[model samples]
Target: MDPYTSFQVPTGDRPKYTGKKLVMLSPDASMKNIDAEASGAALRLAPSSAYKSHEEDYIKAFEEGDGIVFEKFRIAVINANHEEQIKSLLYARRSFQYEEPERYLYALDGPRSSNFGVLLWQMLCRLFGIKKDPPEIDPDPAPKDPLPESPPVFENTGEAYWGLHALDTLANSFTGKGVKLAVLDTGMYLAHPDFASRQMVTKSFIRGESVDDINGHGTHCAGIAVGGTRGESGIRYGTASEANLYVGKVLSNAGVGSDSGILAGMEWAVEEGCRVISMSLGASVEEDSNYSNIYNELAGMAMDMGTLIIGAAGNDSRRSQGRISAVNHPANCPNILAVGALDRRSEIADFSCGGLNPNGGLVDIAGPGVEVFSSWKTPQEYAILSGTSMATPFVAGVAAQLLEAFPEATAREVWDKLVDQARPLPLPVRDVGAGLVQSPK
Candidate 1:
């Protein structure tokens, strides 16, 4: 009988593993040492460095039963189907820092039904002349000083998207020139007209998949981060208009991917010296659950190597139903900046996750997300979508701009500048950590 036969997944719940396990080696462990240890268990491991220039072969080796190690992050992905294999690895635990089952992650785009419900509510409020009560400001027993006034409400015009207006991107002089920015998602539409002339590097970590985005999620996100003007409206949507784009197809065309592929993309970004990496994907976690230690370590390492990783605070909340989910994985890792979603009214999006868990699971900032307009896959050319997924790229693009402006600043310094310059809002810190993200003027 198969061991999985006894297992039953609850409806709507994602399976915890893909019959694979992730292992983080001890800091000083090398490929030579690890190989010797694995040989004792009759296991063969392949190093990613050997196939760095040939990713297809690397993935093929992994799929062909060779335990593959990401040398930079000192992490490995191995099959976990046999009990003896797992036991053997556990027996040599001293050679590893940590080990866990790899979980599946999905694109953070808002669910269609949720987006429709939000639109309906807004329409009803407008038709009935219903006004929402002012948000109650958190009282301070010993207030140091009054908070800055909220930013003016913005509306999209033929000239630009409301997000760009809200961030004052039009007045900003920096175009993020020379900055190497990466967007890891479903992939991008290579032939998108708006981005035809821009500098771009592309790769796919998903097995048997190309970097061409079948799903529009990645194209929309890449547009928000670095695309040019829209053809019809001449509207400006992207932030870092001249940044060198690095497109990493970590998630499959189905908008789902394993941690192994995601990690591979991350390693590639860091190796290529990317200044900022934007990830609009995550797996939902319970309010009481802790973040993934593996991601936390990897993100910290990436930061030390001068790369900043930004991730979407998952779209799992139902504020209308009085439920707010905690910030999701990868983003919940302390070193990765977690961005939440905001609407045109500058209020938190109804479906935006919050910081319910302590420690690393906190929303670090907010960006325009609801009904966001940007480039989509061909035939459509453009689209309007909602979710923290939209918000994340806005922040990533701004980070690239800041990097160009302050050429000598470290990755951590850029993170500080973002929080320091954000326009404070009349909302709780749990929902909007440093308030709304703003472009430097």
Candidate 2:
């Protein structure tokens, strides 16, 4: 079957291929068999255990060889142009399990084009002095015992981001100390003053690019997950203030990346024993499209290795127009925790995707995503943005806190605790899942 036939996107929105292919081999597949099937294509096999010690060599091999095999994941990213050979390997050889064209994924942030339309309409209304009624604010119920503090509404104060207050992070005693949290995105600004005193490890998977976050999306997401207080405002915006940060530049400075780079980052994070892996990037999928088996399998493997992967549900929905899109790829994978976005009112964000499809395409939880303020690239220092991308790292930081609070718990157990401790909201389960995620008190 043609791999592309199973999924469809809008005419111009169809993802572009990277002129490469991802081939998943069986666990017992032999290197000799892969070479024989490759028809003389140059290939390199990289053992997962050697990634940490020989990180640079592994990356170099991937770039120089026709393809590189990840021994741990039993997967290979190869530069293959012979369609017949690939088909023969898939159909004739039992060693080859699956194959798909490598496609690019984008950082999931920034305002959608439709948002500009709304902004223009509001401006015209102001110019004409046309008075409009205030938007209705939903009433959220108070949390049960142990969470005695009422949920704080959105406030642009200089003390802390409203997201931290809504999750009651200030009241939590756990600081995520000793936990390893990985943020896989467009890299981070290593010299940022706010993170100068924190312990961090950094790497870049995008060829020719360093782990310097020029795109700012990764920096903002990292700020929400593990950043400290700002020097000037003294405001605490991050959640896991002391978690050991692992910054992996999977996406490039252009805010785009292919599956090979992303999967390589995932392998590194899992090998490093990171307790939580946060990915604020994804490719859009249609309502009837199924989740990628490759990502689902990798997610399950990571979970078994004691790492819980969290991803954005995508900013493809337009609630005002009554168009709700399905959860994005990877996040739609069952093992990867899918996080939806919530607005300042504790209501679902207008652009947050919904569980419009069955079989693993669902929103597992939500976080404060609208008008979220966090760290940015140099000069700007800080900025406010909105998207489900912001919500993902918020949950990842909370996961780190949970790992610190329950040091003996497994990754799966921590996932269950997040769902159980979430404060129930008066909203549809499709949008909010178990409701707003909360930190352990």
Candidate 3:
């Protein structure tokens, strides 16, 4: 059972591309020299011989397409009309006939029936036996015995912070030295004293801005992931103290970003040989809807290239008020690790999101997010914040440590290691997944 089968789009209305749709084109695998420019050229210059009518409009749409071409995916940022979308989808399907994603279109407005003609096209292909049925969803397992809450053990370790001490970072001496980690979020402030010894690679995907911390979210996340040196107060935070940091300002100073900027940042990180990518941003989505097929494909390619991506599950849910929400976009995708939040008492944070979807959406692990203390922007060099955003980089920093420990391990292997070593908590799997994410021993 394909999990996506559960998502039912109302056919009463045709899909509309109200704004720009991020279109991902499949790469021509046969062409060893198939580059983004070449692929874009193919989509732009090649005659739409498949169209029996309205060829001029289709050519015009391709000519007007403006976007980046990656090694495995070509993102065509276009204000698509119905005809243009249908023709583009058809071209992609015809070009890559086997194992292609069912859909390639993503609307910034939302997932509308009219935007996903490929779903209907997929059914047509099934009727002609061009594709096999997607893999069935595994039935939910019987409830396992609740894991016993592990008692907290406190000791002086470095800054003696409970979060880092719990993971035994000082004892293990796994500071993620020499590993390359990327944090994709608002931005980073390089003038901070903690990062003075580190050489960072930075980029700003948000238009008309430099990679500098302004909204403080990305700087905070970067501090948690890789900020080194003791603060003026002598608190030692950040797990990967020595890891090479790559900061991409995906979100703008107003703390907002689009899917294109985020996607472009991911591509740039992977191209820079980043093994661990941390994202602390997302949009609210329902349980029934899975992440975009484009994100799933991009994550798949990233994993194949030895990069592990982690995202915040979301912070929309308030379990204390009996409100529980599904994981957020991109994080809901299977290949990306969805991190939930935990309080100092080792309990689920009230504001942390959960794994609510019976099928594809679920939290992968837990991290210290509630009232978590870490570096912030200047003037106020420290702050305590709570959200799945705070939790995600903790996991990413630990992932960097794992990469340093197991230098040759693939992304999947590192993921398995984290799950296998997690500290089991007395909580439901839906609330806490495989328990709190642990550090490399």
TM-score, one value per model: 0.93, 0.86, 0.77
Q: Give lDDT per model, in order.
A: 0.84, 0.81, 0.68
- The candidate scoring highest on lDDT is 1
Per-residue lDDT over 357-387 for candidate 2, one digit per residue giving the tens place of the 0 to 100 score: 8877999999999888899998898888899
Off by over 4 Å in 2: 1-14, 30-59, 116-152, 156-158
Best by TM-score: 1
True lDDT of residue 360, candidate 3: 65
Ranking by lDDT: 1, 2, 3
lDDT of 2: 0.81
Model 3 CA deviation exceeding 4 Å by range: 1-18, 27-65, 80-92, 96-142, 149-158
Please, what are the lDDT tens digits per residue for candidate 3 over residues 1-441?
110111223355422222445545556532233233335444332222222133132323334543223334444443333344435444656433222122211111112232134345445765897744223222225577656646463433446466676566777888899999999987888787778777999887654567888777888888889876465656677878889999987766666666656766787788789999999887777767756667777888899999999988887775544567788787888889998887665767666667877666789998887656677877787776778888888899999999989999999998898888888876667777888888887
User: How much is the lDDT of residue 353 in candidate 1?
Assistant: 89
lDDT of 1 by residue, 1-441 (tens): 111121223458766567778888888988888888778777778888877775485676566655788989989887665447656766767666667778878888787686676678778887999876333332223333356565467898887889998788888788888999999998999988888787689998866678999888999999998876887567899999999999998887778887888988999999999999999999999888999988998998998999999999999998776778899988998899999998898888888888888878999999998889999987897899999999999999999999999988889999999999998887777887888898887
* Model 3 lDDT at residue 426: 66
TM-score computed on alpha carbons, candidate 1:
0.93
